[model samples]
Target: MADPGLLGPQRRALILDLVKRSGAVRVADLVEQLGVSDMTIRRDLDALARAGEVEKIYGGAVASGARAEEPGFEAKTHLASGAKAALADAAAALVEPGSVVAVSAGTTAYAVASRLLQVRGLTVVTNSLPVADLLRDNVADVAGTGPTLLLTGGTPTPSAALVGPLADQAIRSLYVDLLIIGAHGVSERAGLTTPNLAEAQTNRALIAAARRVVAVADHSKWGVVGLSAFAALTEIDCFVTDDGLDAPARAALEESVGRLIVAGSAEDSAG
Candidate 1:
């Protein structure tokens, strides 16, 4: 019988499963079980850390566990998969190298961060833990080549965002080339909104600190008003959304925002 060596992702999947079952996994054990070297195990851990799949500690890795109070970050990744991917790709294309950018906390923004990972010489300031973790974990790949990652340290919310006064204070004074934000909902009545009031305030500060504001939301978010509104429709420079948006809503948004970009199709621009 021939030995079938495991591939990278396959090996990583097994490692993740082991971590989940054991709560924590040791490097020595993984090396022995996978028949790989200690260096290979460490590299796998590093990649998993970058993807927010596991928490890498000094000796080994730990599984991600969600508190009863907060929604698990892993769960959010599954929502609006296609729409978020399209929106993220479109948004990432707008980011130029060496640009100063701000990304707010949300699954959609997380998607954008994933795409922006390879962009070189970008100075990214963000309030999302997942975004910060993604960039930080990729430090080796981006060393001297990728963006300088900055986090707005502050109070954390149920969604894993650092918000409140500390985040607001940091954002109010700085300036960035572009700010990308995801909203709970969008409507003619309520511009851009989120369920969290503190997040709303923090987002307003982000809007004020940037030269351009690009709002990313899927069709499902349309007309679903949240508890707080951050910015008015006219205040947004460009609105990026998925093709799932209906023609009438698209027309209305085009009339409202400075420009409207529908991902996965020719843009419907209004300037």
Candidate 2:
């Protein structure tokens, strides 16, 4: 037994975080992580369920239909520190100088924007506030590298992201060389998914407006499936992920997509 009164709000937040990060979490894992009883975790989940914060499944919970399970921008900014950085570098490598690129909204996308600071004489169009902020913040850091930045104008999401009809319309006008997207989940069967269907629509617009599509994600994004999908593996030009993908994943990528770049670095930290 555990004390919900003592860990009430904190417990809810912890479970929510795990649900978002892991996509779905088992009851037993929650008990161990929170040092709480299964009953306690269930109660916490029930509370979140009543609020319509998450949808309870047989063994776990996933983001609700109304909103993404992802936490606020601040929470995402600090997660998977080394992995995000490594993944970002791998993503940035795919971009050639002077090319027009469209980046999607997500912390991992923001990380990609951070590394793109040095990609001089280029143009970047994005719908992410954090990514725009990162591009502006790192301008000076990019002494020899600078790009012309363009931001999509629209209403912000709960995550303070820009997406809606206006953003979609804005994105529709631009035909870019490459569009790099971020996904909450990337599965071979379900494809690239996100919790918000509207975001999915906007992402689909991005995919349609670009010549080549690249998805930059970490290993955590594997196995989870969201309500809405953006593109099938066949539509993607390249899939850039860490080198830790298992044999099945590698085979799946080979069987499904055109090219899969398992961003192998000299100092690989995929483990």
Candidate 3:
């Protein structure tokens, strides 16, 4: 039985471990194992679902599986907010001033774009409408010293990304110093994936146009798989994610990607 004295985070961690190990965990079983109330177990499950760590079912929570359904941009923005911010900070640190960087579509990529505003002389190419709007609106804040922004014109996706022939063609024509991207799902086998085929193709174009690629995803994205694979894990030069990733998943990413960065660890250590 789990220690009854365990705090909320510790209890949640144990619950996540159980779900990861068995692929699913029934609410009643969790209550019995963790020595928590049924209401508490439900609350924990709700929290985990919000973090994208698990999929809630009728009486239990299951490990995230292949997610072919695409969530709208606004819907995704509310999930994993803390993890996304940490990921954004870490990913933005990899960019240098005056470098031409390609930012892909997603809430995480939009976070990275916000952080990039401090990096003077940057030239950003993107297919994300929010990223473009963010940079354009803040032009005066940097006293006209903000990064030069380029937006690819294409058919808009539900995620607010412009994709298709025009986006692919525009991305392919220019080379970028780095590519900071987010994926609908990331896995060892499937790599970076998305439900939208055209977005997948456009993401591939962004990867091809960059000298180095950095994928910023939260720990919750670890085992999730999407319908279409865009870039392989081997193609990612660096992977930045929050510290919620479990040990096995972390080891797997270390072996697959060129480098793995767990955000928030530094701050945790410093504190």
**TM-score per candidate:** 0.72, 0.72, 0.75
Tens digits of lDDT, candidate 1, 161-224: 9998999988887999999999877777667866566888999999999999999998888866
- lDDT by residue (111-166, candidate 2, tens digit) is 88877788878899999898888777777777857878899988876555788899
RMSD (CA, angstroms), candidate 3: 12.0
- List the lowest-lDDT window of 10 residues for candidate 1: 63-72
The residue pairs in collision within model 2 are none
Better of 2 and 3 by lDDT: 3
Give the per-residue lDDT digits (tens) of candidate 3, residues 15-119. Answer: 889766645567888888989899999999899999998887656776766455678999999899999998898889999998999999999999999998879
Residue 234, model 2: Cα distance from true site in angstroms: 1.4
TM-score ranking from best to worst?
3, 1, 2
Maximum-lDDT candidate = 3
After superposing candidate 1 on the true structure, give the runs of residues whose Cα lies further than 4 Å from its correct spot.
1-72
